[model samples]
Target: MKTFGGPVLFLDRSDINTDEIIPAKYLTEITKEDLKPYILEDLKLSGFDPKDDKTKNARVILSRANFGCGSSREHAPWVFEVNGITAVIAESFARIFRQNMFNCGMAAIELPKADLDLIFSHSGQSDAAISINIEAQTLTMSGGGNQKTFPFELSPFDKALILAGGWVDYADQKY
Candidate 1:
């Protein structure tokens, strides 16, 4: 399975739409690699800069509720995949987008609002990082001078999909 967790990109907002994740205009690009430079190009987060080094280096995304809230295309996850973002942890996700993430061998993790609030509290720390242990269903966030661990649960099928490197590979094995 693909390795997950590392330097995190914190998007402190809710209802981030598909268009903002990857503008619709670039969907025509022939290869996933072509979509790399445009990830979150249209996201209007207050302090976000898509061109910033932090954004480019982020291996996971931490966001608020309703992430991937618009459109049903798979391109959003594809953009993240090509950019080397293997996981997105949010308070909630648009159903289709969540499934798309798993289909692409990427994680779409949901934590309760209380847990998200606790995580976001550390957003100000530039060194913030998250370590996810899929086998244990735990997320550990650490930065500055503090660290905390939280528990999460995934269904058996979801776990299988992630372990098998997404739906395609899971199907290949099962069939």
Candidate 2:
């Protein structure tokens, strides 16, 4: 499987439900482009507008406990991937959400509370920099500290999907 290595951006929060990630109203749609504009809409205190924000490229998302804590919609992770979220770091995650992310070939890691805090602080700055090196299993930050690293459960199948550039691409390759 192909691996990811990059900086991280921390967002500190707990129990981020799937409905907050993507409301029920948008589920009728199939295109991820349609879902992109609404990601974290309910969670954003000021409302989220992707066009006006350049954080779209933030490679890693660090959050508090239970990051995806609601519903079983597959669309949750789909929206994240469509919007260019490479990895997610959190204290914990919902089973379905974690599986969905892995199925889609996105990396999800768990870190201690202290490590989570470092990334969270960066969100306030004009330039927040957090780095992730998957092969080395390390997270670096602007302040020069290391974060807790855990195993990512990438099955051989999941790795194939990521290496082939996502599920659809992998499906096409095998078929």
Candidate 3:
């Protein structure tokens, strides 16, 4: 996608592993549709339930460092998309999970720590809209007459896959 923008949810924690994304019990399921109800189930323990009205409708998830650090299960990103998340912005991510996100068609954008902290700080305000421009490699945070743009990076291959709509779509066009 050229621009990732929408109502965002702040997953303020760090090192949120795969087991936490989909829970260990739901691992056997192969279809993203089948895994929707269970997305972010374990977040309930931490008092963040994705099924809740506002959270469930969130199109973006913004998190701190080491997000998706545990397992290499593709189901983690699968469940995210099934639950309506189109993109994820984080300061850092686990390698495998980052790859899985692209494979599953989710935009995983990385930003520097200072920028991430500012974004996190702004999450407290309701009705804010965040926009990320892929080509410019910048994030624009806007709300209530306040706006700021922060620079970010994306690899050429990763950027291409996301713009082409995930790995499968990218391969389909090339092959």
Candidate 4:
């Protein structure tokens, strides 16, 4: 899997659900581009266009506890993928969302709330950087000397999936 690196955009809170990631109404039959506009619409509560907010450069998303709760819609991860959110760092995650993320080439990192607070509380003005070295099993948040290490439980298949650029591409390669 590609190491998660670059700037840290901290969102400190809890109970961010799948529906909040991608509203249930859009779950019906939407193209990837159509779904992009609704990501974080429910939670960010910002009427701004979701597509405009999240792009390839918005590398890391840091959040609080139970990060992907509520319904297990595949669309949740789909929305993240469409909007170019590569990784999410949270205190904890719903089991399904975690799996879905790995399947879709998105890295979900779990860390203690205290560690989360340190990163989030760093500053609002400067552009801070966060790096995750999978080989080293460490997470370093730059600009504040706050660093922590944690275990990531990824199945071999999931790792391969991520490295291959997601499940569909992985499948196409194998079969």
Best by lDDT: 1
Question: What tens digits encode model 3's per-residue C-alpha lDDT throughout 98-149?
Answer: 9988776568888888888888787767776677777787878876678999
Candidate 2 backbone clash number = 4
Report the lDDT of model 3 for residue 80. 75
**Cα-based TM-score, every candidate:** 0.96, 0.74, 0.89, 0.77
- The residue-by-residue lDDT of candidate 1 on 38-107, one tens digit each, is 9999999888999998898899899999999989979899989888898999999999999988888788
- Cα lDDT of candidate 1 equals 0.90
Q: Is candidate 3 or candidate 4 better by TM-score?
A: 3
Give the TM-score comparing model 3 with the true structure, all chains together. 0.89
TM-score ranking from best to worst? Answer: 1, 3, 4, 2
How are the candidates ranked when ordered by lDDT, highest leading?
Answer: 1, 3, 4, 2
lDDT of 2 at 171: 74
Give the Cα-based TM-score of candidate 1 against the true structure: 0.96
Highest TM-score: give the candidate number.
1
List candidate 4 stretches off by more than 4 Å: 1-3, 44-57, 144-157, 168-175
Candidate 3 regions exceeding 4 Å error are 1-3, 44-47, 172-175
Reference-based lDDT, residue 3, model 3: 47
